[model samples]
Target: MPDRIFDFEKDFAGSLRCIPMAVRLKLDLVGIKLSLRQWSRLDRDQRGRLLEVPCGGAADRHTIGAMIEEWVTATGGTIDRIDPADSANWSNTNTVPEVVVLQAKGEDVSAPSLSQWRALTDQQRFALIKLTRPGHENKNFVPAMREFGLFLAD
Candidate 1:
């Protein structure tokens, strides 16, 4: 699996503070709205499987969703739906989301240009959109930019 955990994960690097992008993508695909609290209740091994499990096909999605559902149930957490607004606009690589641009400006990092956005994979785009949403702490926004190669190390 790709190293989706950013340095901003802080204490979460080992157990994870926030849900990683890889798992988040799967959650979005499966339409499950998971919370940080629920994610924290899971053991390291379960979280690790979420990162390693493939969610690329019908079988994969079914398996991954089942695993997540089981985990949520075991944790006594309920599965919820991801906000549609939070999930859309990822397919249009031609245009960068305004929230991302504003977040980049706040961090003094340049937002990815249209061409750069176009070059990114769908997963990459999804991460940016999710990270830059309103009301998020956004500590990982800069780190994500670096991870995506939109921002360079100082």
Candidate 2:
């Protein structure tokens, strides 16, 4: 909700080296797959629209989904859906999920306690879930945690 860009994203902000959280959230809401190529095809105005678009109401979701389809098609990209179970995992906050705990252990970092995990904003939680997913490169997991203020800045 803060519309904050992480310091880790600064290198990519100018060239869109990676898909930012704002655009990723929009893609998630619409059940669309967006490749970096498709993202590059979008002009600044289009990317700005993604960052600013409202996707809260049911009607808004429909409209945004349609808009994303059109953009993806125009860019010669394909669409895809994330599994509901995987999506649901991000919203669960009752405890720190084991995968994340394992990821932290692998990194030799302490997994946050349940209260710290619960206190994270949905976006922060979502980012952590995305980062810690098995077989993911996971290069950004620690950086995301630092950006989310779960760890001190170096």
lDDT of each: 0.77, 0.72
Residues 103-150, candidate 2: write the lDDT tens digits. Answer: 888887778788889888766777777777677688888887777777
lDDT of 1 by residue, 24-122 (tens): 887887778888889888888898888788776668777877888888898778877664233457768768989889889998889899999888777
Candidate 2 Cα deviation (angstroms), residue 16: 3.3
List where candidate 1 sits over 4 angstroms from the true fold. Answer: 1-3, 7-11, 83-88
Error of 2 at 24 (Å): 1.3
Where does candidate 1 have its weakest 10-residue lDDT segment? 1-10
Q: Point to the candidate with the largest lDDT.
A: 1
* Model 1 residue 108 CA deviation in Å: 3.2
Residue 121: error of model 2 in Å?
0.7
RMSD of each: 2.7, 2.3
Q: Show the lowest summed lDDT stretch of 10 residues, model 2.
A: 81-90
